[model samples]
Target: MQRTPEPELMDAPEQASAYAAADFSAGDQALIERIQALFPSGLGPRVLDLGCGPGNISFRLARADSAAEVIGLDGAPAMLQLAQQSLEKEPALAKRLSFVCLCLPSLALPKGCSGLVSNSLLHHLHDPLVLWQAIAQAAAPGARVYVKDLRRPPSPEVAEQLRQRYLADAPAVLQHDYLASLHAAFTAAEVEQQLHRCGLDQLQVAEVDDRYLEIWGQLP
Candidate 1:
């Protein structure tokens, strides 16, 4: 597939709106379910959700495993605030999940985290190697990492498939997400190459769909 143009960083307002407008359709939800099935219960893992706008993935992780300690990190303050608001209504989940405002490329992680999960964030990175380094440094040895993101070109056929099969009734937020994700995604093969270039050879990256790729592996 042909590569799409690299995405430019959205400013604060745009970032906030984009996040607000973000929605995970059935396909995205299925991907998350697959991620959830990977973890065993009662392990009480420490998980990090990078670029966790509105804490969607963070909240989902907490819901998937109440015993896990989930931390959400995002660069935009507004997005963080929205996450906080959502947390307000789910006190049980709110206690287990926390949000931090920091760019993934430079943020420090608490030691001994068991896992790391990021969705729709890698494409926004100007230097993914920096963030990958952070993921490597933060996770404990043998810790697991799962990332779901777009693969480029979002062929007209695939877009139409997504629309007809899953997005026909999608909300505006999701529609925007679908389009933006296309522009922001890269091919699975390309992402795998990048992981090796970043010295993340331990990572295993694979494509899950025409628009979605899952990159994961246990840290060395």
Candidate 2:
């Protein structure tokens, strides 16, 4: 039997470009609700949102628990600036949130961070292990890391349906984002394989929507 070739994932700039118009606020909100449920009160976890564009997810996480200090890190300065501006509009988030511009491949994280979260950022890397290594160094002992990624190898029919359903309703940029994300997404099996190869298979992972996946692990 023959198999289909997987669509290629987008590189960094393309991924960022797609998100230039993507509605991260709504998506992040929904995702944060689930994340919030998984944690106990007192907001003990200091959080980091890798590839945090415009600080949408960072702001939401900070707002979810005022006591929790949240940092939004991205490679793009423009995105970080936008995040800064966005937060400026919300005085409540002033003290609790901050943004940093840094390249992920050379990221230097402070020791003993409580938690790390990356949303839709894994597929942009050629070496996912680079990310895993960084995640390991940044997290405190038993620190929780949650990553939300898109699942790839979507059936032709399903991909088309997504185009017609979600893409069509989105703006031109968001339409592009949806398409790029589809191309960049990895299959659940593929993600599992990659995680195992990266020595992160022990993490508890879950599949959400047909095209959405999440992984949560602790640094030993």
Candidate 3:
């Protein structure tokens, strides 16, 4: 299927709120487990979660390690608002977890992050290379990288089927965004090509389960 890019940022208030309210714990936990399995040495001293939408993964990262600092960076203020609110409630994580409101393709992204990870952030970019370049520039020399996103299905029918199978009972806003994200997602092969183009061919891209792609490896 041809890629159809969605709005890069889910900055709208309702959109952010609905997304924050949705229950993605199952998949979120799986992603975290996958990251841990791939890099058993553990994420380095500093971890950056790109497109951290409400900081679900960010919180997990912080809690998984007492010493590691986790930064959740997203372009949407609305999402970050909720993340900050959640952060405020967790006094223990107040110092280890921080949320930053910054869009991609900017020099402002932290330099030399020991670990870089993102989830479902790939499909939203109008220019996919923005993600690859950002990862390359932001990562430390031997950073561990693990990125997971929905893979574009073969057709609209398949995309809808996946949505209905997994998200039939989700909120209407979430369902709509889910379908759009499926269409906007890239295939495993495409992501492999993207890594090659970014001079990051060391990373491996693989299609996962029914509708996801994963990229993982240590940077050079």
Per-residue lDDT tens digits for candidate 2, residues 1-220, read 1123332233345544566556666777888877767654423558878878777788888887868888888777767766787787898888878887777666476557788888877766656666677777777777877889876644656766777776686666566656656666666777777777777777777788766888876667
User: Which pairs of residues have clashing backbones in candidate 1?
Assistant: none
Q: Tens digit of lDDT per residue, candidate 3, span 124-190?
A: 9999999999999899989999899999999999999999998899989889999999999999888
CA lDDT, candidate 2, residue 185:
67
Q: Against the true structure, whose lDDT is highest? A: 3
TM-score of each: 0.80, 0.84, 0.98
Q: Which regions of candidate 3 deviate over 4 angstroms?
A: none
Worst 10 residues of 2 by lDDT: 1-10
Which pairs of residues clash in candidate 2, taking residues 3 or more apart in a chain or in different chains? 152-186
Q: Judge candidate 1 at residue 6 and give its lDDT.
A: 45
